[model samples]
Target: MANELDGRVAVVTGGASGIGRGIVERFAAEGAKVVIADVQDELGEALASQAGPDALFHHTDVGDQEQIGELVATAVERFGALDVMVNNAGISSPLRRGLFTEDLTEFDRVMRVNLLSVMAGTRDAGRYMAEHGGGSIINLSSIGGIQAGGGVPVYRASKAAILHFTKCAAIELAHYDIRVNCIAPGNIPTPILQSSATGEDRERLERFEARIRAQMRDDRPLKRDGTPEDVAEAALYLATERSRYVTGIVLPVEGGTIAGKVMARKAGSEIPANGAPS
Candidate 1:
């Protein structure tokens, strides 16, 4: 089989698990040397080993500029060159906590991890890619970025910033042939979602998850929730030559959820709350 990305070197932040892991796997399968950068030592190492010789694990805290720089350096040193950078490392605000009483520290943490880290990684990685001519930068945003999520004000703001930052980077780097794009995913059932749920938050989260599951299966037009693979495929397209002319665009991998609101009612099943069929 002809590998679309044969001989390429790709760096994926948060590559140890979730959507980032999927992107890393897809890239490696296409013959790219991958660097998995994450704070998760055990999982990162395990994933690297499973991905074969072309994969390297760099225990990195992406929010730290020094660590991000080192991550880029490691990729270039090991692979001879850098061709793609996926700024996929991120975190969400704790769930069941209303915005009013939310701690500022929690907000800062989310901002640093989800927003500032993308900025740092892209800046460092872009320097390398530009010096070598060009490459692709994929930033992870979310549906909540475009739409409002009631309780997570900080997360919403950070993601919204990510989308705009991607456009700005694209404009500035296009001259160097470096393409920057953002991927906005919706309702991906990842550990990140679960991590947002805590002991006190469990009941509310359970109900929320139930509502989401119902929407995914019978409420949405597609009748399904999106998987990590959906977002990975989008990243793959954006990273490869396939999107040579694509840049500065926020691509929604949200299964049409972003395009249209799917209420908990399909054509034949939307019964009125008043116990009457409309």
Candidate 2:
């Protein structure tokens, strides 16, 4: 799979950093022409430079539907076609005192960026793919969406919407050979966890982040920590023909955190006295 995406064209939203950046680099290495869309001008341009000529940086605010449209148009106009669309731009809602006291002030912005953006990207990209013989669209959700909990409730809701929206879009777009899938990543350390916090909530967010880091120490089924590259690998699978028949599914790259909590035990606790059970 050295060049699994050879001759393909891709557009990755929020490709300046974190998980998005990883996908951009990976896709480029796999021989795909990529458009890195993000509002972070400097970082985006720098990344494009590192990714070589096949990668282009486009200033895009995914919260603005118009910008999203322009992103797709630019990709096709510049690259000749759009084969893979990665909707990875998003923001985390601030932590409130509680759901009862939650003002839901960030509701509109969070929903617009996280949920609506995905819909628009899928539509704009799918429209071209539909007529261009179909392609793959990967939407980035989160483990928070699949496993409910407190804190960042709005952010979680927005991500949860993407899961269903992706599946629905998959069903509707299948006739055109387009495959739509969602990737829910968790336990991957990123600066996104600290975004959108205000005042005292900022301190709380730090503590919450610390708790997450502590939990990831060894609690999950997989002992090692996950990385942006881990999620990028999943994106690669969906982008290639290996997943030609796969669509409307949620792939979790969270070290099996969503499956169930791992019970802690001593290193040799599981071994029986006989030491073997053939």
Candidate 3:
């Protein structure tokens, strides 16, 4: 495993924390020179330093297209190449009582950060990889995009868009040998949800999260929470030659939740459609 990614260069957006952090650490340990990108300068820098000389922190607001372009240039310039591009930085849409209580105020920010950033990162990385030997591009999506239900509609919409966009990018970038894929994680408890909500949304989000956790005892198939490392394992596969022939696909790291609960099969049973812990 340590030699699997030797000589590779990877960029993980939102690498400061959560699933992105797991990928960064995993890639670095596996011998890849990793670039950590995030607006959290403190966390990003600390993680980069901890990862040693082969890793560097690049303060980037992925929501900004110009910044994303600059990030690609910086990665190529610093690392000398961009072998793996992971557009994993994302923000959750505010949770609300229901659709009626939703004002859609976070629409712009959510789309820009969650959706547009992936699009730009792929294009920018694809452009470079297309010329200097194509590479792997992995996008972070959520099961919320896969299953339909309530709360965080914008977040789900943005993720769903990433799924379709990844496929389209894969088709076009395939000419250059760039393999594009996606990871859809669920029930992985990251601070992302709490980090996204504030004020009244906080209380509501807490209760909602508690309910999900309680239900996981009997509802989810595995009945265990997922971790960033779980999703990172999937990422590690896609980044290396192991998935060379794979492209334009979504890999779910969910604990069989995506497959649906099987113990108590009932008609009209509902699955949670909110954004994931990843």
Model 1 C-alpha lDDT per residue in residues 104-149, reported as the tens digit of each score: 6677788889998999988999999888989999999998899775
Ranking by TM-score: 2, 3, 1
lDDT of 1 at 189: 85
lDDT of 2 by residue, 132-196 (tens): 99999999999988999887899999999999999999999999999999999998888887774
Q: Per lDDT, what order, best first?
A: 2, 3, 1
Write down the RMSD of all candidates, one decimal each: 4.7, 2.1, 6.7
**Of the candidates shown, which would achieve the greatest lDDT relative to the real structure?**
2
For model 3, residues 40-129, the per-residue Cα lDDT tens digits are: 999999999999999999999999999999999999999899999999999999877789999999999999999999999999999999
lDDT of each: 0.87, 0.92, 0.91
Winner by TM-score between candidate 3 and candidate 1: 3
Question: Runs in model 1 with CA error above 4 Å?
Answer: 201-208, 215-219, 263-278
Structural similarity to truth (TM-score) of each candidate: 0.90, 0.94, 0.91
